[model samples]
Target: MSVLAHLGVEITSSTDDSMDNRKRPAASPNSGSFVFWSSSFRRQPARVLIVEALPPWWSDTCTVLCDALDNFLSLACNLDGPSRIPLLSLYAVSRQQECVLPFVQVRGNLARLHSCVEELRSIPGEGCIKGAARGGELLRQAVLDSLQQFKQYIRHISTGNQTNNNLSVEITVVTSQPGPGIVRQLEMGLKDADLVSLKRLLVVQINSVGDWGQDTPSPETTYTEAEESLMLGTEVELLRMENSVFALETMLKAWLQEQGGDREHLHLLLPSPTDSPNPVCVKCDMQERLISPALIPLTPNLGVKTESVRDFLPVTKASANQNQPPQRLKVIKLLRADGLCESVLYGLPLVIRPTTCWQLDWEEMETNNNLFHALCHTLRGRDLFLLLQVEPAGGSGVYSHYVLQSSTSLSLLLKPVVSRELLLPCSMPVSPQDPVPDAMQTVQCCLTQLDEEFVFNPLSLTNNLYQHLKSRGLISQPRYPYRLQPAAVLRDQSQPPEGAKTTGSRQPRQVKPHSFLQQCEGHEVT
Candidate 1:
């Protein structure tokens, strides 16, 4: 009967003769009790325990653990599905006795853990066991014993269905003072349990006091050993943390990396400094030199604020639209005699009136337009004419002339000329009474004078003429060839003669003359 039952056979008759003669059909393996047990076992919840080997007074060890736990809880709360809640346990080891806090799924468990850690925090070093010489050994023994008991409990529960057992267990051991023996023992125990398939095993070493030496085992040793001991799918991390928020961030990033979480995209929500009732002044000599208030440091210590995970959904959505191309406006190219050009576009309200003419208010211009400022600076104290060309949709061009005026703000104040003929012959005059000589005529005269002074190379005549004209300010800076537009000529008998003046307009008014050529000549025209 026992053999038949093992083969998934059911027996109705109890007589020994009938049992010996009974025959039952073989059942499928998937329908057996073992398969059911395996499926049920795989669905079991995960268990995580944070084990602290060092005492509370060991250089902010307790505080670091509590901060880590708070980060973990924040991560849990932000989880999307049913995995948000995890079964958590805490254990604290000391020379006197080991304290085991059982796993609980209640909301108050975190509060209880915080209170327990605080109570442990209040206990001074004098209250601890006086066996300072054997403290490291005792702590190692306690950790080994606890791991052994945990393994035994798991094994005992999985006695009958050992092949189908799929429970996952994770233990995070955080310590500042780890004995060499403890690390070796952990390495050996984890190596032997490779087939048991533990979920995760992380060892965090806090170096608050900075006493690492030959006696103390380094984190690299544990990391290399743990990598070799753990199963292919299992995770093992060996982290070392200093007393800083950046160190804690590194630890959390490592933890999330093992779980296949997006480490780079996560943001930490820190408490706002504005929450304090009184304003605090943070002083720094280097920061004081910066003009922007946003660049100044608000506090020297960032660890005072608690950190939590801010979800990535809203941040992702906000950034998704951030990279849209900037809107472009229609702009006209304004070229200068110096070969420097600027793009003119309206960024503010453009008003054209008889009073203001085409005055551009510098204060109203966009502060970001650096080209405008550069053009304004270059055009200062110079007489220039702008040839305005507008191409209409009918493929016809409309042309006009505007005298470019420089103001105190160095902005362009364009005064439109009534006749396009005014643009001809480069309308800048050396003085009110004396019109500036034509650029070609001036270049010819300068070349003749240079020829008289010294026998000049015939091949260098054009170059020498440009240099001479540029020095005389007849040609502008950069010395490009200046071409004079043809003057308007009438081809009718009734039209006025070439030099005739119209009757309606008053005679050209002469203002106080300020000659740029006179100033250049005073400086020897060099």
Candidate 2:
């Protein structure tokens, strides 16, 4: 049975089965998707119940949802590992039908702590839905394990040699594809306020050229960096990060190669400073000076307290989407997971915002005209970053059981909502393998990004229930992207005009005005 059916929904098995998962109509174009209950009322700390009667497929969505939490989706092993983590994790839970997402409740060890909001928000104005759902089973499993393992890796703070009772972990996810801020928060969670022991590990699997091209896997060892380094590193990467997967992958490979390319994804693990490694590097004054500026130090006599430790918070992780082929899926998923909101590790719904960026395949565009033409022509020639939201239509024939759930009205959790900055942009980097840049620098060399759209759940007013719920709205009325993208500083050249400079910096520096023809004061002065 499905989670929805358990909650009083009625969907047929054959109709909602895997065989019918496909045939569903294309989702909206100018839409972005985020997860929230489609039911009414945004009551505080409500428990999300997946009942026994819930349909079998309902959990599928949750399964997918959990995998995407915190952008820690399934990623390939080192481009050359022993077969990419097999791409998945599947488990049968006892009462997952009642799997709970308590928004307003965090008691016991977490009573005094402030409520943290974990949102899977959108990037500026766009989203990456439908296709992402197509990641299917293999990718799903990998994503699950990675997330669980990550949860286990998030602990940075020592509970002061206290008992396990004193240890508890809590995290919140924000969206907008955060670069460094999210890392900072995790480091903060695991370190001292002064960020003396920023033990949060940061591993990056940069996007790579086609076929991953013999790149080494990141190390499997755990890592931790101090606040100063974490913050600086965050700023540098976030500001200088390219939307390009290849670039990211390459940089990571280079760093990992130094530590021996034996681990996966060329992982860069920063261990707690207090722990002893080889003392040779620390004794080198020049080396110390070089690294000291980039890294902060941990307190003396430090030890890894197992109890208070949080799960592994990946500085970055990747997962391949099944529907779009492994390669494309890998790139887009990371793009979706770049923000603070997209950083969940375990079964937590860190940031449930809409998908802001999308990676689309050309042929797929033909199925949906609104999105097709929208991509063909900007909104009034306005190339703003737009988000497309989509809900997959499931069931038999054209209309399937999945369709009903996707089309169903929005829940209170989705309404009465407040969100900002969940903007959109193509994740393709302007340049591949470029060095870091300043805070405001952008690699605008490449302007074309995938033009895609998704579903838009239409909001409806209850017969007479709307008045009382005026402040909040129902997340209903599903619509697809007629067009996606809002105007932005980044130019979209996918549909550039004839003779237009197809590829180059959009904002060329103003060259000083020079004389059209400097008179040569040579021997024959003209």
Candidate 3:
């Protein structure tokens, strides 16, 4: 027998013997074995240490530094797993050069760390009392000292008899002006460390001030160093802090992409707009309230929810007639799976008169319109189809459907009836002697198939269709209605005409327009 079956037989025999033995009173010696096995499978929580370089001369240094620390703490509070009690440490780079290194200042406990961050917030306002001649260089050394302290802490935790060695470690440096000296010192410190396994070394640069001169490193230099760090298998990123919510969200998304943990279970907490005693809880409440409406059922059948689709109607002026109300058309909005609205319609006024049945002013539509370009950006790399419904001003239920496809550019797809019969016939070869009425007859046939209530003018539709065909290069421009270009003709030149003279060698025959239609019948219009 195979090893698996033999093992299964042994397990069955053991279970049978245990069941028999349970009838007789015995000591429960192995009952706790299952608990021990499960304990071994549980994962140890990760510990993250954040070291920030806060200079006294920087503008709004305290506010920026406090905000970043608060943001990191908020993220820690939202982490998943019962054992995931995240340890966060924050240190402010000092300007004074001291002989003794600063201790592992912040502890792992959340309450204690919160108090430490609150204490550091006041340093920016008071300013550094004893400033060193080379402050940047001193700050760099302080950061290295902090890293060494963190490594010692990791070693101490792992060496304990009762401690779990599965814990991961990460170090993040937050700074506004990171000079080359700081970068070199950090690289050397990380390279020399062999005892601790560093998960990630992140450098976050907050650009609160607009000045890019002497104090701040240039973009090219920062990019080159970041690239080198990545090649060495270190996770490094430089983030510019922006006030806009959209910009901040984009930055966080890029950071999340590099994370090695489970993204679905991970939660990122940002600072609340308003100052609150408990900012993390306030932020969570605001998010739930904002997204609650989208979760509600808006349809009667509970088939389609508000989160999946939305609808809008154009604002119209009051009607003059007291007997009836002005007509309003429904515009349906559909969202992609990623919760992004791909298209939105702007309700423009429609003009109706005896001369012009029911038409929208193209000039007015183009004046203050940017929705098309915005849609292109939102729906990039995806195909978008818009179904426009144009209804008459009266109480009539009839409406026309116009399909528009939008991509890098927009195009109008002629209705199936118009394309197959009218537009296709116009491009087909015609005899030079025949009048253009033959093609016009095909358009008339298509018109008969359309609804009688369709308000668009036949002449206008024909002209627009012809222009669209010309732009797509389906047919040459009409010099004359019946004139045919040589390129448009197709004929089989294998045999000569019955009355034509035959020479010793065969010669190419001139193509006639009448015979071209037979060859082009199989061509399909895009």
- Using all chains and alpha carbons, the TM-scores for the candidates as numbered come to 0.33, 0.16, 0.35
The candidate scoring highest on lDDT is 1
RMSD of 3: 30.6
Looking at candidate 2, what is the lDDT of residue 235? 24
TM-score of 1: 0.33
Give me the displacement of residue 389 in model 3, in angstroms: 30
lDDT of 1 by residue, 336-436 (tens): 43441221210111211122313456644444246566555665645342434222212223232323434346355443222311111111236556445
lDDT (tens digit, per residue) of candidate 2 on 343-443? 11112111112222356455554445445344334422432222222211121111100010111211100101011111112133376655666311322
Give the per-residue lDDT digits (tens) of candidate 3, residues 1-526.
0001100000011221211223433323342111111111123223343434345444345565555555544443332212222234445655543322222322223465566667666555434433222444554455455556656665675675545433555555555554343454455444444424556556655555534346444332244555455432453444455533333333332321112233233233433323333323211110000111111112221111111112122223445443233333234443332441212111111221112223447665554245545654454456444444445323333233333333344322211001100010011246778647954554455445446654445455544766787787645545443444454343533355788877877654555556555456665333
Better of 2 and 3 by lDDT: 3
Candidate 1: Cα lDDT at 136: 41
Better of 1 and 2 by lDDT: 1
Cα-based RMSD of candidate 2: 31.8
User: Candidate 2 overall Cα lDDT vs. reference?
Assistant: 0.23
Q: Give the number of the best model, judged by TM-score.
A: 3
